[model samples]
Every structure is written in C-alpha cells, then in structure tokens.
Target: MSLRQRPLQASNSTSRTTSEPPGQPTNPTQPNCHPSTPPRKGIRLNRILGRIVPIILLIYIAFAYDLVVVRYAHRHLYLQRRRTLLPIVWLLPAHGLFLWSLRAYLRVFFAHSPQYTNKSSGLISWLRTNFGAAFPDPDEAQQLEQQRLNTLATSLSNTEVKIELCQADGQPLRCWRDNCRARLKAFRMRHCGDCGTCRVGFDHHCAWFDNDVTAPATLRAFVAFLASIPPLYVIAFGPLFPSAWHTLKQIKDFTASDAVIRSKWYNKWYSWIGGPAFRWIVGYALRASRWPKPSKDRWPHESPRTPVLVALGAVFVFVATALAASSLTQLRRAMLTVDLERAKAYGKLRLQMEKLEKLTNGSDVEKLTAIRQKMETLSPTQYFKVSTKDKNSGEEKESIVALSPEEGLLSRGSAWANIGRFLGLKQASSSDGPAWLLSEPALRKILQAAALLPRENSN
Candidate 1:
C-alpha cells in the first residue's frame, strides 16, 4: 500500500491487559503491569509524528497549488494580452485532477471502512463509502474469510506440511510487538502499531499518511492518487511550458558565467554570511530566479518562486511513478507491504539454495561449508504449524515448520488471480463455492517445495 512509498510473532499470551496509552483506561480484568517496565519513549514520539506528517504534506501541496494556479495562471497569464483565456483552459482539467487527487489522498489517509464494520465503528464507515460499495462489504468479507480458511485446512488435511501458527490452547495470538492482544479478524491481518488495531488487509503504517493502508478501502485510492500525478503535472504545466523553458535557459546561462556567481547582488549579499553550504543553496536559488533574468515589468510567471513549482511537480511525478511501480510489483506477486519485508529476509536463503542446486553434492567442500554457515545464520523467516499424523495411532500432532527457500507465504498462484484479489475486484462467490480469497498470506504452497526444509531445519 503505497502513497510513496513483521515476521510471524505467534504469541500465546492470554494476559487480559489491553494496550492503551498511559492515561487511557486499562483492561479491568487484568492487574496493571506498567510498573514492571519503564514506559517506552518511542511510542509517544510516534504518536506526535503521526499526527503532524499529513498536516505538513497538505501544507506542501497547498503551496504548490497556490504557486501554480494563483501565481502563474491567474496573475501572470491573465496579464499576458493573447493568453487571457489560457488559464481557464489549463486550469479546467488541472483543477479536476487536483480535486480527484485530493479526494484520493484523504481516502488513503482515513478511509478504513472494512475495519469499521462492527456496530461501534459502523456508521462512520458507511458514511465514508457513501453507505455503498467501495470494495469488499463487511458481511461478505467475513464470509469469504471463513470460506478461505476452511478450504485451506481441507487442502492441508492429510498433507505432511509442518505448520506452526497454532495458539497453544485455541487462544488468540498476542502481538507483543504492539503490546496488544486484540483479535485480528481480517484476512492476512497484521496489527498496526500506530493505528492500535489489526487492520484488514493491513499493509504498512505509512508515516506520511499517518494511517494504515488496508486494502479494498484505501489501496485503490492510494494507487489512483499516485497515478494522477503525471497527468496532473502535464495539465497544470501545459500553458506554462514556454515560461518554464525560458527559466531553465536562465539557470543554464547563470551556471556558465563565473563572474555572475562572485558578483551578482543575489550571490554577493550572503556569500560570506552563510558559511558555504547555505550560500551554495542560495546560489542555486539565484540560478532559477535572478541571474540575467528580470524583465522591465516582471510578472508572477517570472517570480523567483516559479522554480519551486517546477521542482516540486517534477519530484512528485518521479515519486508517484516509483511508488506506484513498487506497489504493482508486490501486488502482482500476491504480497502486501509487510509481506514484502518478510520476503527480503527469506530471499537470501533462496539465493544460496539455487547455487547449491547448480553444484554436484559435496563436490566443493569449502563452498558447501560456507553455504551451511550462511544458512545457519539466516534462519527461516516464519514458521507455520502443519498437522502431522501418527501412522500407527492415527492421531494428528502439530509441528512448527519453517518456510523452505523456494516457497512464499502469501502467494495464491497466478499474477492475474493475485491482482484480482489484491484489488478486491472479484465479487463474493456463492457460500457453497469457494469465496474470493482476501489473501493467502497464511500458507502459500509451503509443502510443495519441502525438499529443502529437512536440510535447512537441520542447519
């Protein structure tokens, strides 16, 4: 879940304490456990930063809007005799894109509808979706989640896969990392430390949005917002293209003249005052602003701040492109943001396994030894509890199985199928048939590639 840009902790603690802030109410069933440990300062800091990041981002966006629309289009272009109507032409689609992007931005930040399906959070969630469909409806999602799990259990019923995510006594898994034992009902649920809840399709907690991007609600909007950037830039800058080109020429010309750097008033005034870095920055600003540049009657299009619009627009374009690409790549692979981080750790093990496969067994003793040493250090990222049957007694026993190098935890096969699920594009199936999979981050084909597990688990 990008607007940019955990290992399985199967905790079995049944402590009744809810993870609330210092001043908030604690769980009445459990005794207070605060005195045993010092309060973590990091949590308080994360709270402060999360609240302000979106505010700062909005401020930045607002500044760009003013610079582009008010300053350049209205003020400068209107004054230009032949171009009076050009601002309207440029701003019509520009404003449309801007409003659409703004809506998507807010949706990305706060539209966690699927997570709010319960009576407590129901009304607001309905309002967020206009009391209509965004993606997966709450009732449908719950049904789908149950169906997916049932099918999964059925498939692994008689298999030899050693899974490890069983709660010791059918109790809920405690997320010690977040200091919460909240029930995670959503598909592929992960507890977001910042949000203080397990979000449905929980991706990562984005610091910039100050929110979590759980799919079927915020994922589509996040992608839409990023995708709008290039078109928005093109529309906003269409009329100002000539002026921008001229400004680039001024900067280029300014750089070639050594005399301008040492003698221009913009450069000379603060040259000694700011040590060197600050003065260098001021010089860069001058290149875009004042060097060989002022007309007899300078318009807002020729203002020093014009470069700010260009630079910001260029940067957002690049950022949106990169973040969008990264997100699509992950979605196509059937993993969310948190799953991607887990993959990075396991990816190292896969590389070694591939190398070992190429060489004959025991052919190079040194290479084999080095591979073993590396594998020992890089333990499997996640463990799942697969039920093993005792052949004679006909009883099932659960064993914690580590992921083999070639296997992944989230994939449900084909890219199209994965993306269809990620976007929540598929409608719910009949309750009798297999419902749409929200995500299979539980266990990919964990047993299909079981040959390496025996050796790696030994390591």
Candidate 2:
C-alpha cells in the first residue's frame, strides 16, 4: 500500500464486477499532492492576486465605460446627427456584449461553475443539482449547492450505499485527495488547492476570476466573456474607429510625428528600451499626448484621456483575444490546460527514454532502468483498489488494477463533438448519464485493450 492511502471502510455491498487484472495496481494516486498546491488558501500567488484582479478589472471597466460610452460614444459629436437613433444603434450590440461579458465575469466571481462533492454520487448529481438545465439561474444555484451537497452527504453518510468507482477497464478509479477518496471522479477531475474542492472538468484556477473554471458550467461563460471583447470594442467604438485607427497607424511608425504636434515623435527616450516594440509603445504615448482638437493648435491643453484609454483598452483586448484563442484551441483538442501541460511532460519523458535506449549500450543498464521507471511513472496507466465479495465463501477480497489513460481523456470522437461535449454545449438526455464520462463503447475498447472486461456470469 502507498503511504498516502488509508484503509477504506467495509461496505454491505457484495457485488464483484470483475475477476481479472483490473488494469494496473489500483492504489496509486495522482502526482499532484495537496501540499504541493496546498488544499487551502495557503498564501499562494493566485490566492493573493485573485481578490485584487477582479477589483482592478472592475475599475478598468468603469474607466473604459466612462471614456468610451460616457465621454466619446455618448457625446454630441456621434449622436448629434439628424438620425440620432441610427447613430446610437451601434451601442446596442456593444452594451449586449459588455453585459454578457459582465454576466460571465460575475459567474466566475461567484464560482457559478458546476461543482461536485467529493463523493461518488457527485458525478451524477452535479448535473441535476448544479447550475444547468434544471437550475438555470446561477445566482441562486451557486451558493446553495455546497449546503445542499453537505445535507446530501450527511443524509447518505451512514447508509449502506456502495461507493462504486470504475475506470475504463472496470477497475477502481481511486482519487487520493483527502476529501475525494470516496467520490466518483470524471476524467480530468482534479482538486483545486485554493478552492479546497475537487472540480470535474477542471480547467484552470483563474486568478483574474478569483475562482476555478470547471467545465459544463462556467467554462462556457469564461470563454464567452473573453471572446466577446473584440466585438464589444469594435461596436463600442463605431464613430471613433477612424480616429482610433489613425492613432494606431501613428503608433506603428515609431518616428512618424503628427504634423499638428510641435514636438517630433522621435525622442532619445524612446530608444531607452532599445527594442522596436518598446519604441513603438513610447511613440503611442507621445502621439496621444500630441493629439489635439481639429484646430490649428494641435497641442493638448489638458491630459489626453481618450488616447490613453484607447491604448489601454487595446492592450486588454489583445490579451483577451490571445487567451481566448489559446483556450479554444486546447478545448478543440479535447484537453484542458492541465491535460495539455501533462501531455507535454509525458511527451518529453517518452522522448528522453527513447533517446537513452538508442544511445546506451548493454553496460549502462542502470541508466536505462532509471529511464524506464520514469516512463512508467509518466504513463497514463494508474491504479485503484477495489473490494469484492466471493459468492461461495461470502468473504470480501481487495485487489488492484489499472485503467487506460484514453478512458480519462475521451479524445476518441470527432473533434467538434469532443469540444461540444467538454463544453456542455451538447444537449444531453437522461439516459446519456454524463458528458464528462466516456460512452460504453469507449469503455469497452479500453477494457479490451487490457483484456479485463467483466464476465456476464460474475454477478
């Protein structure tokens, strides 16, 4: 037995699902121990910044709203036209997108994601009890979930209910988290140190949102908020687009000074950074400072709030766009940010082993052995212990087996389907069970790979 594992309680259930090699030894835990990330608010960087980021974002958003809508778009210059309603029409979509993003942001802030308890039943009950089709309003559903789950856990604690957890190969799927050992876990289900809760479809603990973004609930909103930024900015800056474009064009040419401004855009201070990108950024500041009213005197009498806000907004939009693209691309590949990172490490480990195998002669057996051990450690195959009762003796027996990594991944279907399923964009029927898990056929393939499907007569 591993040092991390504890002896499980005996159950009244006598069902034996399988009688063969489950998959791998069924006791090995996930590599990420709680202490490494710490299962509580342990003065981590994300924990500290999470509180500050949303406040910063809200302030920025307020500033941006004041500058763009209140100051610019809502001005007489844009809406002073004869057909004022037509000119103000563009603000509709901008406001919609802004509100949508805001809604999503608040959803993240409130931890409106579908969270599962650290129990086997959480796998199924989350769909029913969490913020989904049944409970559509996230504001009400979010906080009550924990209380509801606590009540459920208390009610079910002493019952004779079996905590069934089977991986792809019909082996026990063991979670080593202190809170989640008895819970049914979907693939990619992980414990968030900051939240101190196990999340299925765990994406990343976003410091900006100050919350964990679990899939099938909050992932949809998180990505939607990010993706809507560019369009929101575009619509928000309808009439001001020309001036904004001109400023950006000016910013592009580091030495290109505005004819109206007295001082040249070129300055020795711009070259202080000694990088082209840095120099161009300095140029934007200089150009914005020089931006004047449509008059002979192009120098600004006061602070250039419009140009500065525009520049700042551009930075936010750029970051949001890149993040959105990166997130979607990973989801399209049927992977979370965590899975992608793990896959990279696995790939590197595999490559090192291959190189070592080819380079080393028979004399360097120890080095090769060490590499082989690392490969197995990195392998997707993992174990969990299962207790089964013998029919004849009526005695319980414990054994271990491994499950395939593919079972957890669910990367076998069409790419679009995979993305839709992971995002919970697909409508599910009651019979479908959970989209977070693999289908029966998918499980059969994994089981056959290990030749460990249970016998029909074993019941």
Q: Check candidate 2 and list the clashing pairs.
A: 23-402, 24-401, 24-402, 26-383, 26-384, 26-385, 26-401, 119-183, 120-183, 120-184
- The window of 10 residues in a row where model 1 has the poorest summed lDDT is 1-10
Best by lDDT: 1
Q: Rate the local accuracy (lDDT) of all candidates.
A: 0.56, 0.54
- Tens digits of per-residue lDDT, candidate 2, 1-459, equal 011222222222322345553234543452322232223434688888998988888888887777666555554435443345654676777778888877767666655333333343654455334432221223233233333333333433332112223432344344554445444443445666666555656777888888777766677778888988788777775556556566555444523545532255354554646688776566656666555454432312112454556666778789999988898888776777766665677688778767877777445778767655555434454443344344455544443434555554356366676567656764531333344444444444433333234423535
Model 1 misplacement above 4 A: 1-40, 43-53, 82-85, 113-144, 147-172, 177-179, 182-187, 248-279, 284-296, 346-409, 427-459
Q: TM-score for model 2?
A: 0.64
Of candidate 2, the 10-residue stretch with the lowest lDDT total is 1-10
Candidate 1 C-alpha lDDT tens digits along 1-459: 110002112234221222322234435433221222222346555567778977876777787778677777766767654476777877887888888987888676655445455534465665555522233443465566555555655654443322333232222223333333333233355556665544556777766566667665577777888899899888877666677677666665766675665577444665768677777677777665445455757666765456656777788799889998998898887667777764565477668766776776657766766654444333333334344553455554443444432455555557766665666564422222221232344333433233212223434
Candidate 1 is scored at a TM of 0.61
Candidate 1 positional error at 188, Å: 1.6
